[model samples]
Structures are given as structure tokens and as C-alpha cells.
Target: MAETRKFLSVETISLIVAFAILAFAGFVTARTEQQRRESGAWVRHTLVVESALYRLDGAIRRAESEERGYIITRDRAYLRPKDEIATQLEKGLAEVGALVADDSEQAERLSELRPLIEERLEQLQHKIDIMRAGDFEAAAEIVRTGEGKALTDRIDALVAEMIAQEDALHRQRDLQMSEATDTLQTAIGSLIVLIAGVAVLAVLLTERQLHALRKSSESLKLAYNELIAESTKRGSLEAQLRQSQKLEALGHLAGGIAHDFNNMLGVIVSSLNILRRKLRRNEGGLDPLIDSAMDGADRAAALVRRLLAFSRIQPLNPEPLDVNSLVIGMSAILHRTLGAHIHLATVLAPDLWPTRVDANELESAVLNLAVNARDAMPTGGQLTIETQNTELDACYTDENPSVRPGQYVMIVISDTGVGMPPDVAAKAFDPFFTTKPIGKGTGLGLSQAHGFATQSNGHIKIYSEVGRGTCLKLYLPRYLEDSEAVEAPPQPQPQPPEEEFPRGRPGEIVLIVEDDEKARQATAQGVRELGYTVLEAESGKEAIRLLRARGDISLMITDIVMPEMDGARLAREAVFRRHALHVMFITGYSQHAIARDGMLDPDVNLLTKPFSLAQLARKIRDVLDARGDLPKGKP
Candidate 1:
């Protein structure tokens, strides 16, 4: 078998060398032509500028000469020539304006020149008009005053300055053109020598390149296969990474919810056990233990509400609140909360602008920060709570991509304590990511605070350095009034009730519609204990049927979340049937289900779930008593 040859033949190598020489000559020729064109452009531009200036100067001089001729000889011919010269001057000015259009400074100079030349022409014409009217003395007096001479001299100076600028430009362009010509000539000679050298080297370089290319082609094929395998691995890893992240987020959410719920349950269980022991011992009052349990339930409800807020299911009901007033009101509680070990200070900014936010949530967030700060300062430290009206400008919003550029009311809480390290600080706002010992912290404080701020269209920033200190800044959007300042709400005037709330009458009826039988029975029992006749139904449709049949039913109390039909729809139908029927909504679902945009309808009453027996009594009594005041129609 014969081996295949790799290298090119002598004749083939010669052909490649010839092609290299031709390519080199072509490149040199193209470069030389480009340089010549560039030089020509520069020279042409310079000449255009120079010629425009020269024409302008000439028009000015001719107008001045024509004026002088008419003034000295009093000849009409010289005066006739003035109009034509004026037209020429206008054209010259226009030409100069066009020439310098690209250069702002020169264009501005041209603008000044036009006005100066026009003013000089006007003066010349003024003198000529006086002479034409046979007021020779006046014309002679004007010329003697040197006013005409001064105006002409000013015009001359301006034109001369413009011409000088053009001349300087022309000189610079000429030098460039000269250098380019020299470069072209030198490039041609160098390219000839380079072409011969390149032709000789082409054969040698081609042999080396062929060998290198063969090796590179083989290497590329191997690299391509490796790349495909690596890409497949990367794709699989990415899929795994995405799944891991989703699971991690789910865990964080579930863990945070369980942690808070467990704490509340602990309180309730302990309180219940204590109350039972006391009952067995024949204790007089178990109010405190019962109250403890109620408190736990309330906290659990609050946690649910906050979670809804974090999910953006519960809309915000922002009202104009004075930051200074809020800070002052919370100072007492903050002082007590921080304990005697830590010194609490309030630097309330006077006359701070009002901000729009949910006051309850704002208070909770502030309190959370204070508590966190207190925990940080175990031994003793200073905790400062300050409020100020601030503006988050474009630069700040740019750096902080989450923030919007606007006026904000800033609440800064700073603590001098053992600060968090960088890693802890970074994850401080991540749910269930706590640095505290087990059971010490829920880790939802900062996360809840962050959620509140973001949901309010505001921003919160945490600045902490290990062993230095920590500062939590909460920025809420400012409330702007269109015309007058926002007036403070009038204080309620004390008034006695018209009459005592009578105990439930025999005919007074309260209908309780709840899907869950246990909840339904408990609610009915609460209403019955309140001295009112109770009617029970397991669904909205059942309650509506009962409402249609019973005329004695004074009020309808229904659960907001139920199967088939909701309390809202039930209330609508019941109210339609009985125009005077008063309705109250109870809900275990999120506020969004029972309320419109987080605000209970003004005409419709609401009672949140997990209420104690006392709360249920009060709500039922209130709705029954207000029966006469309810709107007599569907709402």
C-alpha cells in the first residue's frame, strides 16, 4: 500500500506565494486610497469654513464702504447700492451659520456676528436717511460722534475673529494632509518590500499551518464530544439545583409556620393545665389562666394574618400616620420591653411628615426590632429609636434595586451590642434562619418586618458589623396632601347611651350559619348564653331558607368561609328577603375572603375566628342592638 502525502507540491506552493503577494499589494493600495480620501475631506471642510467667513467679512466691508460713499458724496447711486449690499450681507451670514452648524461654539459665534452686522448696517442706514432728508448737519454730527465708526469697528473685529479661527483650522488640516501624503508614499515603498518577503515566507508558513490545522481539527472533535457530555451533566445538575432550592424554600415556610404555632400551643397548653389544677383545688378565679390561653390564640391568629400578608393575599389598608406621634406612643412600652439593663432613648424628629402604612403592622414591626435589639444587648447597652423625614433619591434607589425613588419617613433603630457577623446578617431576613440557640428565637421577626415593608411599597435595610453594632432602617412612603395639610381626626366626645342594652327578648333571634357542626354548636351556645334565642344551620343555603321562614330573626351571623356558598352571598340573600336584617361575618379564612382589600365593609360587621366566649358575646350583642341602625337592603 502507498502512504498518502500531506505536504503540497512545489508548483502548488508557488501559486500560494503568488496569491500572498497579490493580497499584500491590494491591502497597501486600499489603505493608501483611504488616507488620500481622509486628507481630502479634512482640506475640503477647512476651505468651506474659511470661505464662509471671508464672504461675511467682505459683505460687512462693502456695506460700510457704500454707507461711507453715500455719506461723503450724498449720491443716490451709493444709497441704491446699500440695499443690494444688505441682501448680500444676509446671504453671507446664512452661509456662515450653515457652515458652523456642527460646532456649537462656532455656531453661537456666527449668531452673534449676524446681529452685530445687522446693527452696524442699521446705524449706517440711519445716517444715510438723515442725509437723504437734507438734514446734512445731523448726518455730519452722527459721523463726528464716532458712533458709526465704533459700530463698524466692532463688526470688523467680530468678522476678523471668526476669520482667524477658520485660518487656524485650515493650517491644522493642511498639516494633517501633508503627513498623510508622506505616510502614503512611505507605505507604498514598505508594502513592496513586505510583499516580496511575505511571498517567500508564505510557503514556509503554509506548511506549518497545514500541520497545525490537522492537529487542531482532531483536538476540536474531541473537545466537542467532551463539551456535549459536560453540557448534559450541567443540565442535570441544574435540574437538581432547582429542585433543591424549591424544597429548601418550602421547608423554610413550613418550619417558620410550625415554630410560631408550636410556641402559641405551648402557652395555651400550660395555661389550660394550670387552670385545671386550680379548679381541682377549688380556686376562686381562673381568669388569668384563661386570659393566657386567649392571648396565645390571639398570637396564633396574628401569625396567620402576617403569613397572609407575606403572601400578598391580605391587601394593606394604609392610613396617614404621624411618625413622631407613633414613636412617642411606643416609647413607654419599648422602655419596659428593653428592661432596666438597657438604656432606651427616643429621638423623635419634630414635625415629621406623615407616612401611609397599616398602623398595627407598623407598631408590630417596630416592636419586633426593639425586642431583637434588647436580646442583642444582654449585659447592658444603649438602644436608640429615631424618626426623621427623608428622601430616597435616584442614586440610592439605583444602588438598592428594590427601593423606589420617593419621599419616605425613616425609622432607624440602632443598638450598641454584640453585633451579628456578615453571614448571619445576610440571612437575617430569610425565614426560619436564626442564629439564636434552639427555642430562643423564632427567626420570623426580621422576615416579617421585611415582608411588611415590601408589602407597603416601602423598603427595609439592615446594617450590622461583628462586634460593632446593628442598625435597622425602615422606610415608609410619605403621604402627600393635595392642598391643605392633613387634619388630625377629632377626638371623640363622651356621651352616655340613650338606654341600657336590655337582655335578649323572647322573640329576638340570632341565626348562626357555620359548616363545621362543632363550631356551629359552640357559636350557638355562646349566643344562647348571651340571652338570645339561637338558630343553627350548617351552610349558607340552609341559613337563607331559615331566614325566609323566620320573621322573628333580628340578626344573621354567618361564617365567611363555607362549602357551596359563602357568608357574604348568604348575607346578601338574607338581607334581600328581610330588609331590616342585621348581619355579622365570622371567618377562619384569610382577611381577603371576608374583607374587601383588607377592610371590612362599613355596612357589614366582621368577627375574626378563634375568639373567646366573651368576644363572641360582645359581637353578638353589638349586632343585635344595632339591628335598627342597619341599612335596609342588600350590601
Candidate 2:
């Protein structure tokens, strides 16, 4: 028995486990490396194929364009680019052929694509040759036959097929790569778990042996220590894995919903504008109806904004603000919204630090929190808004990895309503995870608040119990540098009367470029009514042609999103030609254009969609009135 036990001793078992781990790690590394090489090849192949397809399309288009130019202007110089583009296209196709040499199916597709492109190019060349031969009528007849267009369309379809194949191949390779990565992660995780389990098992077996052999107490203690250490490490790793999974799920949700919602909102906003205008022109006594409609539209807009915030897609226009003052200013609105049944109070620190944040977004976040509290208390409750200057130390940051250790302005909203249970409170920040009945609440309030705080380099947390109360704390980083100076409460400026507002200057030709017909005509009519000469185009390309044909244009008011050419690109081209051209961008919704990540460009004047007629009038007046000497490309 003693001889048999020697082979199963703890030291021997440890050595065997160590060798197993090393061998397993080596196997995983080799497999991962092979998959990586395969993935890289697929990526390169896809890129080369895509590049060839685009070049082929471009070359075909150029040949047709040159054919038209020679036919129209009878200039042989137009034919020069055709040869050059063809040469480049051949080189691109050669590259793609080499890339797909390993895939027979794709190579066959490439084979089909090359001939179609050549055939189309040859047809275009034939027309040019005929035109150069002084048979203008024959060339014109050939062009009229539409044969070149037919051939080019066939070439495009073939190239698209080849591209689709490559894309499918790329997706396949990506899926394989993902599987490899997941496998590697699983192997590594399993290795760790195995090591911990083996260590615990060895310790247990060793302890049992120690007791049978009547070994020293110190030996038993050592074995127990090993088990405890492995268990603790395993628990930590599991917690981290769960956290990573949660974040990945949240990212998927954010990406899935925002774009479609924004587009629908755009249609709603534009239709609303048209309705409001028609109502104003006639005394339909529909003022209340319009106002009510506007209110609902505004509320819908707010909901969209909140969704954007939760997704972290909402851009921020941060400005320095005194924390106490911002709260004080909102106190009145907060009280009104809270109603008489709920008591509102503020416990602001006199020396609270100022912070830089998007004032409107911050105000919205506070209001959301208040509204959420109101819902929680149907029978009435005390609502307190408190602000304090505080510092988060290393100890706090260590536990909350998302938070930074620095000076922060803490805004706490407390309520005496029935608080959330521990389980409910845990998931309070998840987007659209609401507890209220249908149509009563959007689970976005807390999520948006959380997103805003984090994006602004701050943090947020919640504390609640089943019945006692609830408190939500928002930690926003305090401004450490020069900030907005504390000033006396501002006096409300009287708005200019309807007739007092600036009107468009006479003969100041304003170009309106908008893709939506309803939106474009509405804008054009509004500017024309303002006494300015207005030129309207439904696309950016048309606007460009107009810009070139007319030099009297003083302002270009364009929607940032359009087909063929976007407003920004148009403005850039227009500005390049006319450096003093004034441009204004308006958009209903976009993740890009005139703004990035919700922050508006200071250099370009911007007006959001669903704007009133008065707002448009004032913006145009302001742009035209300003010294037009600002640098170009600023938009």
C-alpha cells in the first residue's frame, strides 16, 4: 500500500497536471495561429475583390462618359481618359484574379466579370472611333441604339455578382474566425478552472492522507489554504465574465433601434411643419389644436432624445455651468411638474463646484429623474434635489471600475415613495427595462441618466429599499480649470415682435437644397415670403449646378442629408469656388453631418428640423447679416 501511495503522492500529481496544462496550451496556440492566418487571407482576398469591382464600374462609367463627351463636343481629348481608366481597370482585375485563385467558384465569377467589362469598354470605344472618323451621324445613331447602356448594365450586374460572392466568403471567414476566438477563450477559461479544481482535489486528497498518516497540523493547514485561494480566484473570474457579457448585450440593443426611429421622426416632423404653416395662414381657430399637436411632437422628440442618450448616440454640446444656479433655475419647473401633492425641496451646497456639461441634456436628465420619482409615488411623496461638492477617493474607484477618482459634483434625488426591491434596483439602469404598466413609463429615464453621467466623464448609482425610500446619485466631474464665471441671475430678454425680427435682404439670392419635396417647397416658400429671392433644388448636385450658373447667390440653406451628394460636401465644393459663400445646415436626425456624437460644429450654423417659420427667418437673417468674411470649409 505504501509503494502504491508513492505514485499518487501530491508532488507527483502536481507534476502531471503541470505537464498537461503546458501541452494543452501549446495545442491551443497552434490552432489559434492557423485560424488567424486563414482569416487574414480571407480578408485580403475580399478587399482585393471589392476594389476590382469598384474600379471596373468606374472604368465603364468613364468610357461611357468619354463617349458622350466626344459625341456632344466632338473633342478627341475626351477619349484620352478612357484608355487610362481601362489600363487601371485591367491592373485591378489582375490583382483580384490572383486573390481568388484558390477559390474556383469565385475565380469563375471573376472570369465572367472580366469579359463583360471588356465588352462594355469595347462598345464605348467603337462609338468614339466612329465619332473620330467624322461619321457624326453614325456615332449619334449608335449612341441612340442604347447598346452601350445595355452592355454597361450587364457588366455592372456581373461585377455585383462577383462582389456578392466575395462578401459571402468574407462573412464565412469572419464566422470561422469568431468561432476560433470563442474556442480559444473557452480553452483558456477551462484551463484556469481545471487548475483550480485540480488544486482543490489534490489538497483534499492530501488532507485525507495526512489525517491517515497522522501528519503535523501545519501540513493540514497548508492544504486548506490552497483550496481557499483557488476558490476565491475562480469566483472573481466568473464575476468578470458575467460583467463582460452584460455590456455586450447592451451594445447590441443600442445599435439595433436608433436609426429607424430617427427616420420616422423626420417624416413626422416635416409633416407637422407643413400643417402648422397652413393653419397659421388661415384663422381656422386651430391655434389650440396646433399647439396640442406641437406639444405631442415635442414629447415624442424628447423620447427619441432619451433613447439616443441611453444608446450613447446623443451628442453633447457642453458649456461651463454653475451647478447650483442650473438647479435653482430648474426648481420652478420641477415644482410645477411635481404637482401640489408632492413636496419639493433642494439642499444645495453653497460652495458647489461648477461643471461643464450640455446644459439642456443635464436639465432633461434631472427632469427625467423627477418624473420617474413622481410615477413611483401615486399617493404623494417628498421629493428632494440635493447638490454637493465631493471627491471620490481611490478606495471608492477600486470598487467601481467605471468611476474615476477626482473632484465631482454630486446631485442626489431622493423620494419617500415605495422604493424598488434589491432585484429591481440592480437592473434600474438597463435601457427599456421598465417596471410600470404599458404606456405609463419608458425604462429609459434611469438608463439615459446613467449614460449621460458616464459619457460626461462622471458616474451614477442608485440606492433603494422595498418601502422606505429611494435615492439616485449622479456624480459629474467638477470643472477644475477656468469655467463659466458665476454671474447674477439673468434678466429675461424681451423677444422681438413679429414685425421687428430681421427680414431677408432684397436681391440676396438664397439657395435651398432639400431632398424631401414637402420640406423643400415649404422652406423655399418661407424664404421667398421673407422678401429674399429664393432658388430651390431637390438635390445637392442640382444645387451645385445652380451655384456654378449663378454668382449672385448670397446664402445656401441645405439639409445635411441628401442623395448623390450631402449638404456638407456641396458646401465644401461651393465654398471652394466661392470662399465667401454662407451656408447653413438643417437636419431632422443624423448620426453624422454638421455634427458628430451630438456635438454641433461651432464654425457652422445649424438649425434642427421641425423648426418654426420664425426660427428659420431669424437664422437666415442672422447668417446674411453677419460679415461674410469667415473662412470657407468651416461648414
Candidate 3:
């Protein structure tokens, strides 16, 4: 009886101890689970706050961008999303504020950020309103004050601080969640140890809890990955913005330098022409000096043209061109240019698509490439020019951002010469970059080609291997014809001898409008020497005044770009006053008056500056004689 009684007591004690252990483990697990849920909620809240901040920042940036675009372009399309952006900004800011309400520091940052954001938005709206009122200068003045930027910088700083705070909270919550998970796991282990008969059940329960924890961890990992992706995307956008700014600065620099240099060259060339004309009959030794000076001026003018081309602001005259026919026409010139040592070949595709491009620029680009290829093949090599119909799909255009997905006429120039390495080829099209010996290259050839291609809405790429030679592919968009009305390319006209200068007829008067004093005098003197009466004005207003006073003016040649009243407006006013007054535009660089999208309007009668006397004479004569107004006995 005593042994049985002792056994019963021990059994009861074991059961009681097991029950107590299970109850303790369950209680600990419940508490740990509660802590983990709280931590998870905090983590999600932080993510929400971060996401709202990003959206707010993005909305403000978009609004600012649209505002600037409207100010510059005055296009209503930029303002189309104003209401949508406003909504997003309002919603994003409210969400962020509500989410960060619990944190005092975050709430303080938000409070500071709210006023700045409101001020920025208000400033943006004010500038936009000013732009709408057609007061561009006023809007520009406001931008130049740096007030908007200051507000934006402060907003960015506050947002950064808020995000930093959220990140810290997220980390802390994650650590707490990890600790809770560890504690729950330890409690599960203890429960299994105390309850041996229900070991399988405890293990199964532990597995379920572990699975839930793993799923939560995965969610956190995914959120982290998304954050990393956003950061990377922002970095890429910043890089692209920097590149765009650099290119814009370079363009401005190139344009200013080219304009100034062109004016100087014009003075030298025109003065030289006047001096040569005054001494034409004498057999003086000055002929050689004059010829050399003229040659140098012409070379300088060519360089200026290249610079303009590189800046992508040169005036282009695009015509429907058949690439195959163009290649065939240039065969003789290519043969001469490549020399006898180099073998030139062509693979012209039949029935190729026609593209609209500036024929002269295309010819120049081809010549430049041929010269580069010849230099690459010092000893002698085969050069091939091929044409084909190509299609650039999304896959290709995705890799090349400058290109669009569409049909293109591909011009392939390949050389069996010494090729370029990867590093050298990468920068092959950069202006002023060259691998040739000094004095052998200007380094603008490839860059000019690149700019020309881009300006024409085309793309160019170079492929090379160190040992295998190089290939350059130029893609031009295919021209779409309307109603089967394809215009044939204009043939080149034969030039008259340089000595032949077409003189003006009796009663024909030429009025010259120029901004520069020396250039004006030089032009007036040249026109007078061409046997025509001349008038000069220093500005467009003066030119208009001249036109109002003089009704017998046969031709009014004006600079396209001028302060206050531009040439186009002046021309309109002049034509309104005198219906018969002929208008001509001359410019050191292209302006919006005569050019659109970097192309000269087809109907515009324009003459580029730094022109030789012969070119000037011919252009003037052509404009005068276009209406058959030339008098008898006029050369």
C-alpha cells in the first residue's frame, strides 16, 4: 500500500510540473508574439512614411520642372497636369504628416517642411502666372533671385532628416522583432523539453511559428531591396541631369565663340576683298599675299562652320535624299579623296528607302568619315560604304536613348585598317578628342558628324576591335511621302568663274542692316564696289525707319538676330509698308526667325556670314533676279 501511494504522488507531481511548464511557455510565446506584431507595425509605418516622403518630393520636383518648362517654352501642355500634381502633393503631405504624427522629432520636421513646401508651391504658381501673363523677363527675374532654390534646399534637408529618423526607428523595431522571435523560439524549445509525449505537436507548432517569422523577414527584405532600387534610380537620374547641364554649357560656349569668331573672319575676308578689288589691275606682288590671306580666311570660316555643327545649331536644309544615288554620285570624289593606295568599294542596296536630310551636310559627314578611315589605314586598306533598309525595334532603342523605334536608312562605313581600342572608341565622337598626330586632325570631324546626325533626328554608333578594324553605322529616319508625292533631290548647279561678279542694275538700291559697325561698313563697301547704291543701318529699328523713308529700295538685307525687334518682325513690318521690297537675311549663326528645329525654312532667303565676295554676289543676284527684275545689260 505504501509503494502504490508513493507512485501515485510522483505521477501527479510530474503531471503538475508538465502543465506548469506548458502554461509558462504559452504565456511567454503570447507576449513575444504581441511584441513582434508591434515591431512589424512600426516597420510598416516607417515604410509608409518613407514612401509618402518620396512621393511628396517627386510631386514638388515635377511641379517645378513643369513651371520651368512653361517659362522657357510658354507651352500650355506643360501645365496640363497642374491639378493632378496639386492633388498628389496635398495627399502625399497629409499622408506623411498623419503617419509621422506619433514621433515628435518627425512632426517638428514636417511642420518646418510644410511651410517651405507651401512657399515653394506658391512661388512656382506665381512664376507660372507671370509667364502666362507674357512677362517672361519677370518670371526669369524671380528665378534668378535664388529664393525658390533656397526653399527647396531647406525642404530637402528636412525631408532627409525625417527619413533618417524613420530609418533609425525601422532599425530599432527590426532588432526588437528579432529579439522577440528568439525569445519565442527559446520558449518553444523549453515547452518541448518539459512535454515529451507532445513533442511532435510542439515541433509542429514551432515550425508554423518559424514559417510566419520567415515570411515577415522576407517582407522586410523585399522592402529593403525596393529602397535600394529607388536609390539607384535617383542616382541615375542625377547623373543624367549633370550630363545634360554639361552639354548645355558646352553648347552655349561653342555658340558664343563661333559667333564672335565668324564676325572677325567676316571683317578680314571682306576687307581683303575690297583691297584686292582696288588693286585688281596692277601686277603687284600683293596677289600672293592676298591669295594666302583669303585661303586662311576660308579655312577659318570652315572651322567656324564645324563648331556650329558641333553645337547642333547650324542651319540645315533637308531634302528627300536617296542614299544609294548619293553614294554613286560621290564615287569619283571618294576615289580622289582616299588616294590610289586605298581601295574603295560600295555596296548600295536596291530600292532603298529615302530619308530627308541636308544633302550637303551628309556629303560632308561622309567625306569626314572617309578621311578618318584613310588616316586609320596608313599603309593601305579597303574601305567600303554600304546602304540598307533597317528597322530599330524597342530592344535597340532601349539601349540607345537618342534613337527612336522606327524604320531607318542605315549607312555603314567600314574600314579594313588599324582599329581602335575600347577606351579610345568610346570617346571617338567627343569634340577636340583625337588620336592622330598634332596638326593632322582638327578632332571636330567625328563630333560634327555626331551632331549632324543628332540634329537630323538620327543616331550614329561606332564599333571597333583592336585587331579587326572599325565600322561606323549611321541611321537616318525614313521619310514618309504623302500621296505618293516624293520630291526628287535637287541637282548641284555649276558655279560661275570666281572672277564673275554680277553687278546691280540702274535704280537698284541695297539697304544693309547690321549690328556691328565694321561689318556694316565692310558690307556696304563691298556692295558699293559691286556697282550698286547702298544704305546701312546699325539696328533693326533703324532699318525699319530707313524702309519707311525710302520707297525705291530694291533689296533689304538684314541680320536675322537683333535686340528688341528681330529681323523677322522687321521684315514683316517692311513688307507691310512696301509690298515690293525684297528681303534677305544674313546671320553669323542661325536664329528662330529663319530656322526651326535647327533647319532653315524652305522659303527663307538666307546667307551665312563670313561668306566670300563671290558667294555674296551670287546670292544677291539670285534673290534680285528670282522675280526676273534684272535689267538688260546687267552682268
Alpha-carbon local distance difference test for all models: 0.76, 0.76, 0.78
For candidate 3, write residues 277-385 as lDDT tens digits.
Answer: 7688764566665775677677777787888898899999999999898899999999999999988877778889999999999999999999998999899877878
The residue-by-residue lDDT of candidate 2 on 1-635, one tens digit each, is 56554347666677587668757876886787688778877777787778877776776676678778878898777777566767877987887788778889878878887887777777777777777789999988987798877877777787778788878878888788788777777777776777776777678767787786776667678888988898899889989988998887676555434543454466566657766777779646556655656665786777778878877879999988887898999988998999998878777888888888999999989999999999888899778787877666553565577876767888878776788876899999988778888446657889999989888988987866556457788889777554332442212223346586568777799999998898799788878878889999999889889989999999999876565776767877888888888988886432122232122443677775445456778888888778443323323
How do all models score by TM-score? 0.44, 0.36, 0.38
Clashing pairs in 3: none
| Count of clashes, each model | 0, 2, 0
Best by lDDT: 3
Indicate the TM-score of model 2.
Answer: 0.36
Q: Where is model 2 poorest over a 10-residue stretch in terms of lDDT?
A: 590-599
Once superposed on the true structure, which residue ranges of model 1 sit more than 4 Å away at CA? 1-194, 199-225, 269-283, 482-635
RMSD after Cα superposition, model 1: 31.2
lDDT of each residue in 435-540, candidate 1, tens digit only? 7787787777887888999999899888664554577889898787744334633122222232332356657888889887987897887678667888899988
